[model samples]
Target: MENANDGKYVHINGNDIYYESYLHQQSAKETIILMHGFLSSSFSFRRLIPFLQKEYNVISIDLPPFGKSGKSRRYRYSFENLANTVIQLVESLHLTKITLLGHSMGGQIALNTANIRPDLVQGVILLCSSGYMKKSKPLLILASCLPQFHRFVKRRLERSGLENNLRFVVYNQSIIDKEMEEGYLAPFLKDDIFFALTKLIRDREGDLSKDILNELRVPCLLIWGEQDQVVPLEIGKQLHKDLKKSKLIVLKETGHLIPEERPEEVFHYIKEFITDKG
Candidate 1:
């Protein structure tokens, strides 16, 4: 499934993980691993990958049950397991020092990975992440309780026309082109994929508030969309307050999908951060 413009898969843990490797031709000394949010794939980094590849070996992967990756009904989709799979990918690729960049659910996975294997990661970048949000919508809370119900709802939403239903989740409707909508819909169309997503949501619905932010010692960057309705701007502010070494950049006229909505701005900050660290 290798395309002329995108990268191919490398097998890991009986799953064919889809990833795009950029700057492989160049002699780069650093590696930047990009992880996309829930229901999203490596395609989320389409805008920033080319720019970052100029200096670092940039690699982006589609999380399990998302994108071209295989989904299994038997496996549990917890953040810890996702983090382990990511660490395996890093080790399998022989990446020594990595700058991990994660968006939304991917941000949670990145933090988990960094907490477990701090030595392997050099820095962390989180975009509109979800660890700090304690309260969600009542429907989301109910869906978390009933996994099957959640899958059914997601299916109904997608079949009923995802573009319209997803307007609330995305900041700008124009950012979600036909291809992007199709990409978002692809995973939920599969039964196994739906099950995996349900499991992930259910597993992370508890109160994760306390003091998890204090565990992060790596240099961190928190980017948020001021108009974000999914994970609210307040959550990002709370994250910045809790994480001492982290810096927050709130972009105006942006929503949950910061990387997609404002790719150039997001990339500029990320590039500057990488350069300063290097």
Candidate 2:
């Protein structure tokens, strides 16, 4: 039995990237790369890993500034830079023709990566993706732009705010236990994490445009929680409408954390999509 918790680190783009690989014996040809969203780590996919690893090799990555991965004050935090680092990681591992699975912000990074190297990516799976949604709040953007405000923003993300965010994103409040909070809050224990996150928000380029989606050559699957308040279901619908080769699936009684809220359904959807041989 593979221990999904064990992880390794690799140097990519001058930073150490942490990732966990579940290499099942039966399925070695196909690979699935899991990318988590903002304020999240690879740990978000804990429930889905075992289910997916049953028939396919799974690799979950910790994007820097958010997980156990190394962070630096000087590194660029734009989505383009993040995509480049992911590409470098893929090349370093000699992984090819992968199914790129991303959640929330990770979805944007996945799309960006696929757009850059269609040759390496075979398909894309987006869970409550963000790039196609409404533009970010101008006030927040302005706040992020001012370097002096970074500390203020950092101070504002108190435990209460974190708890409130958890409640807002996960429809089933019962699952918001101590363990879950601790897991999600672990990365913040590192010094100056808020500064890193602020940099990420401020440096990110504009959202992924329809023009970019139209140019995507690989297959895409957009999965959403019908009750998602963060990104909303309409965004997923719009993405499906815009992406010529994409399909959408919305789960009931769920929120933004579909993978955590309904892992089995997500597993089935992904399995059917990947196994259809389309």
Q: Summarize candidate 1's per-residue lDDT along 30-64 as a digit string, tens digits.
A: 78888998778887777777667766778888888
- TM-score winner: 2
- Please write out the lDDT profile of model 2 over residues 14-101, one tens digit for every residue: 7789999888766567789999998899989988887888878888999888798877767788787898999999899888899999
Candidate 2 at 197: error in angstroms? Answer: 1.6
Cα lDDT of all candidates, in order? Answer: 0.77, 0.85
TM-score to native of every candidate shown: 0.86, 0.93
Query: After superposition on all CA atoms, what RMSD does each candidate show versus the true structure?
Result: 3.6, 2.1
Clashes in each model (backbone N, CA, C under 3 Å)? 0, 0
Candidate 2 stretches greater than 4 Å from native: 1-5, 133-148
For model 1, the run of ten residues with the poorest summed lDDT: 201-210
Steric clash pairs (candidate 1): none
